[model samples]
Target: MKSKGFGKKALDLLFPPRCQGCGKLIDRDDGLCGACLAKYGDEQRESCPVCGRTARECSCGAAALGSSFIGNRRYCAMTFYNEYNADSERITEKLIFRLKRKNSSSLTDFFAREAAAEIMRLMQLSEERPEEWIITWPPRTPRAVLEYGYDQSEAVARRISYYTGIPWKKMLVRTGGREQKGLGAEEREANVSTLALLRRKEADRKRFILFDDVITTGATVREAADLLYGAGAEAVFPVCIAKTLLKEKTDDEGVFV
Candidate 1:
């Protein structure tokens, strides 16, 4: 244990930990600085009065779930995403951008910790056994994989499995399709239709925690959930790092208050 502590100190000296959000020096590794965490973390969370669920988990918005399949599935996210927000330095979006454009162990590790906690919440909410549930993510487009050299969702899912002792598998494949970013709701739905089951036999009678980086219009995840259902999945619970906030939640200034 002394040797381990010595090694950690040496490593810290060589490469001092910095906040993944703003590059501020920090005492810990693989996490955000306290200032950044306080400014952009769960302190900003809002809840729905009627459902007593966080903004991400609330289903009160009329346009929240664009897919019937998603409407029926249990889902939640770590935070809210509002692209139109005036704050250009929003750490949630910045972290997500870093997650896609680079291979940052700190960022992935941070997401994994959050994902593991959220997955456990979903498991408890659904009364499902942790050992019986499987972790899976929709494979990124071929173009994305080639450009980024990694799948962000899969990376987080694997890390979650490592931390939580749950099994992670590659269950769904994206058969060459247009990127979902910057697309309208209908367009996103059409693009997600390209997803197909990679292993139908493996999915039989299993419950899945569908992990993804973001949930917008609920198209991609919903389609993935439908494929899993068709393949005989007993239940599908969707979880993501961020969820697009409904218009009402976004103030006139385009900020999520």
Candidate 2:
């Protein structure tokens, strides 16, 4: 059998490491090149710390707000993309789409590290830390998984677990449902309402931080939080890599305009 070191060298030779953001060849697999890394340095400044919306337009409603979820739950996100601005939003969307659809390993690692940092910040800001905090995710439907050949949320969750030293579990299972994409706001909520169930005996009064790739309408994560809360979780925190913000437009007789 080939030695482990030799095998690693051979693999590296066959497929060189590339930067996650720009796909440029890099020395390591874990980070973006300096230029790509610089792009995300101001992400927090571009997003609302409270609502995870872009600074220019962030009127988050009660349901859409992360703190309004059940069971003393709160939501937080890493970056916000304003949909009306195609130039900026496309940059965010490209990263997310590559991660979800292409299963980009470097992007996954990058997001996982970012998420771990956010969790750490939350822990520091919390009034009292929980006895134990577990990592979990709202699973994708089996059909979607089969079609995509991977689960994006699960991938990120495992990486977050690795980075934070918190245990990760597949606590929720999707009970087959239509895809949430292209659905209206209410339809999106209804589509995902009964889609996920807590795995048997997995939620035993533990605190959970549910991870996802993005938060558009907040319906999917809300449903997942409801399941965790129902399964006796003491608290549920929803975390995402990106938050989508709706653009504001005035009507013909808009007084504010």
For candidate 2, the C-alpha RMSD (Å) to the true structure equals: 6.4
- Tell me, by TM-score, which candidate is best: 1
Report RMSD for candidate 1: 6.4
For model 1, what is the error of residue 45's alpha carbon versus the real structure, in angstroms, after optimal superposition?
Answer: 1.5
lDDT values of the candidates? 0.74, 0.69
Model 2, runs deviating above 4 Å:
7-9, 47-73, 82-90, 127-131, 178-194, 246-257
What would the TM-scores of all predictions be? 0.78, 0.76
lDDT of 1: 0.74
Candidate that would win on lDDT: 1
| lDDT tens readout by residue for model 1, 58-135 | 654323332222333446677767763333577887778888887888889998998898677656765757898788
